[model samples]
Target: MNKPNKAPNNKEFPLTRETWRYIKRRQKELDDAFLSKAKWLPNDNARLSALLIERGELINEFPETFKWWKHKADDRARIIDEYIDLLHFLAGMDGMPAALFTMDGGYSRIMFEAETDKWRRLSNDYVLEQLLDYSPNREYPVQSACKVVALATHIMGRLGFTDGDILVAYDAKNAENFKRIAEGY
Candidate 1:
């Protein structure tokens, strides 16, 4: 698989080609191990549903993002962890192309200039729209997958997360997932 090109124009979103490669390799390892134990692969519809569910879980970490009246401190660490959890499934989905990790110039810009809550809501809605477009019957599932990845990366960037943060969190979560599989989880 071709590695992603240079990092995007935004320095804060420093997902270098090496980082992308590591993520792909690690996720593949996790998927292979999981499949070996489970002995059953999910269909495209099932994968899509899992992605949607994970997205919901990630959103749930930031209640203040949607709840206008609920003012609470943002649990930044939990939010990032949830986002990485979503990535675990997204990266492992069947036929997730290497190009999904490639970030274009357009994605480097924030989708919304509004305040945190408004921008987060808008970005989440946009990502949901892309996720809803994915279907097993689609002529080009890769295209839909690409849209989701780009939107997902954009969300991370908007949240002010660095590529380093993703790598660290992914490693932690990945290790935990492996531990779970070993324990027959």
Candidate 2:
């Protein structure tokens, strides 16, 4: 829905919540295309694998800050890319609908469901800090990856990523994903 032909306007999407709605609309295309079976449940092994793969990709962008003078912000874009990649890893699990606004107190915590029609919250940051870290609590299924996506939006806010950037980038990725699925990628 981003209009790249015109000037960038963060106000177009305005809030993280609005951006999420946009994301979910596009995500449904993938869910429908890929998991069109009765009880289209997300596989635990697949989720964990995707999570770790994305997390490792994020880590690979790390550069040792041997000295304060040696630090570079150029990787900011790469970091954000990796963060979004992490969110995409959890995109397809059934749970609560996306929120109309950003989630509060989401720092270091992951939101998921542990039972039918039930929502439970947990944090993935603790496990992420460990090397070869992986969390296998499929019971703590990501009710909706939008929560995790919101966490990425929060990070983007910190790195000066405006609503426009997120909205545009997300739409762009969504289209690319659709193409990949169409091609059986």
TM-score of each: 0.68, 0.56
lDDT of 1 by residue, 43-138 (tens): 545565676676666666665655557779668898778778766665665354423333222122222221222334465556444444534334
- Where is model 2 more than 4 Å wrong at Cα? 1-15, 36-41, 64-74, 95-136, 143-152
Q: Which candidate tops lDDT?
A: 1
Kindly give the stretch of ten consecutive residues in candidate 1 with the minimal lDDT sum.
105-114
Positional deviation of residue 74's Cα in model 2 after best superposition, in angstroms: 4.6
* lDDT for model 1: 0.59
TM-score of 2: 0.56
The number of clashing residue pairs in each candidate reads: 0, 1
| Per-residue lDDT value at 123 in model 1 | 57
